[model samples]
Every structure is written in C-alpha cells, then in structure tokens.
Target: MTSRPLSILDVRSAGPAGRALCVEETAVFQHPLLEDPPASAASAEDRRRYAILQRRAEQTCLACPLLAGCLYDAVVRHDVAGYVGGTTARERARIRTLLGITVEPENLDTLAGVIGGNRPVDHDEVVRLRAAHPDESLERLAHRLGCSLSTVKRHLRRDRNGGRTREQEPRSRPSVRAVLATARTVLDPARGSRRAA
Candidate 1:
C-alpha cells in the first residue's frame, strides 16, 4: 500500500478560506509565553504582556476579511506554533478543552502525511474496562491502561469520544479479517493512483 503526501498548505491552497492570514504576516509578533523566560516568576508582567499582544492580534484579526476562516482552521486543526485567528497556542488549547474537541498530535507532523484515523487505545478495550469498573476514577482508569490521564479522558470523553457506541460494543475489538480489509483499502502507487476525481 502507498500514500500520497498532502500538505496542509496544499489542501488549504485548493480552497481560498484563509489566504489573508498567512504565517509570514504573524511571524514578527512574539507570544508572551514564548517571550517571557521566567513566566511563573513574572506572572503579573506576563499576563499584562499577553493581554496586550492578544488584544492587538485579535484586533487585527477582527479587521481581516479572512478572520472566520483563519480562526476556524487554526483552532480546529490545533495549529498553535504561533498566533493565528488572534489566539495563542495556549488559548487554542483552552478553546479545544471547552469545546470537547480532540485534535490528534500526530496530525501536526505534515511530513508524516495523512493518517486516516488512528487511536492510541482500542475502543473495545476501553469499553471492557469501563464496564468492569464503573466505580473507577479517570486517574485509576489511566493508571490501569498505562496511559496518561489525558489519554484516558480523551478515550472516555464525549460518550467514549473515539471509542465504540453501544451498537458497536459487541464487536469492539476488530476482527483480523476486518483489519486486513482496512489495510487493503490504502491506495497503492503501483496501481496508478486510485484516487477518484
């Protein structure tokens, strides 16, 4: 099986949603968190500086024609290396937590190419654990799975967020045949790019 590499920029270039807020325009600005060395020690100063820059960036974004598109892409995709859509990386993380959204970190590695859908934990295993120990706290669940607390929360979030539904619980663990079938679905370059137009 083969995979065609699709850069985020290339996909965005196909559509004209966020062209106005390119990285170059925002590169000159410094994020307070990144700029401040002793952020914890300089809490008051950091907050002031952060507020000023945040306000300025947001104000600029508000005036841009591409504000909505930029914000939508930035926050949804978790592109928090620098400011876009007027929000810093930390701010975007906050937004994600509030919105019940989970942007897989692996997706950020553009060089790795597109990963269709991969979860760190199997859906069925999570379901089994939850069913077996209804009284367990999130921390305990994480400890049991040998995964981070956040990973456990991510697995269990939003009705088992990326886990299985009740209808699919009976067959939570994928069959070997099913796994092979999924593997066979990947496009092979030797087959001359099976992508449909």
Candidate 2:
C-alpha cells in the first residue's frame, strides 16, 4: 500500500461533518483505552482515575457517528498498540487475526506510517550503543537489539565496542582426547635407571 501523510485534523477531528461521517475523537484517543488498566503498573489511585476516564471515553466513542470509518482505519492498519481511531491493542490484534493479517509490531516505522504510531526503536539508539561501547561485545549488541546474541550479530555486522566483528564464527572446541593424552605424557615421563657408584 502507498504511504500517505497524516493530518492533525484526521486525529483531532470530532463528530460528523458531511457524507464522510463525523470526526472521531473518542475512538482516536479513548481515555480508557489509553489508560493503564487496573492490573497495570500505575498507582492504585491513578488506576482508579484511569478506569473512570476510560469508561467515559468508551461511551463517547460508542456513540460517535464515525465509528465505522474509525474501525475501518484501525483494523486495516494492523495497529498492534495504542488507541487508533478508538481501538486498543487487543482490539486491533483481534481485527488483524480475523482478517488474516500478521499482528506483530516489529517494524514500527511501517506501523507509524499507516496508523500514526511512533517508532519503537530509532537509529539514535544504535549510535548511542556504538558510542557507549567503542569495543562492543556480542552481549552488549544483543541487549541493544532486544534479541539473543546470535540474532543481534546476524543483523549487526559489526560490534559497537570493537571487541570482535559480528561475522566472526565461533571457534571449534579443542579435542578433549588430545588434551587428556598430552596431559598424561607431561605428568608421567619415563624414568632411566641411575647407576650407583
């Protein structure tokens, strides 16, 4: 699909105007949908307030005349998170699943282009990781990628800390039998008979 510019009006418009249906606000920024749920990381009081706002926002969105259009946009965009035109992550995931669309939000830029979402990770993070670790190790790279060492190395061709190149393969393990045999020979040398005068 072709990318299009996101308009503030598209986000802020409220209520019906003409044949296009009223602007959707509640669905676009449903307070309840935006609030961390009761089982979230917020304080108890904050959670209570969030629940209240969420309820009101849900009510407003439900009554909005542009609900259909908002739903269409939210579903088609494969938005995995946030209150897009009124749908939550759960709602969006369900819509995508029903439509046979993959629901992963790995490519945040693509999602943002379609659903007006923010990038999950940015290049600055990569630059910072590189700067902080001038001798970058695989472990550090993995942490930055939020993936396993192998996965990080696969994508990142160079180490940020300068420890090793990402393309460096694992060295083969030493032969255990060879090591044991060498150790035995070193520990037990043949003794020559000494002449007693």
Q: TM-score of each candidate?
A: 0.37, 0.38
What are the runs in model 1 whose C-alpha is more than 4 Å off? 1-18, 21-24, 27-40, 43-47, 106-197
lDDT by candidate, in order shown: 0.45, 0.41
The reply for model 2, stretches above 4 Å from the true place, is 1-39, 78-81, 103-197
Q: Could you give me the TM-score of model 1 versus the true structure? A: 0.37
Clashing pairs in 1: none
Model 2 C-alpha lDDT per residue in residues 61-117, reported as the tens digit of each score: 555655445655444533333444344455554544444444222343343453234
* Model 1 residue 92 distance off true place after TM-score fit, in angstroms: 2.2
Model 1 agreement with the true structure over 42-89: per-residue lDDT tens digits:
569766766566556655654565644555555554333445654455
lDDT of 2 at 63: 57
Best by lDDT: 1
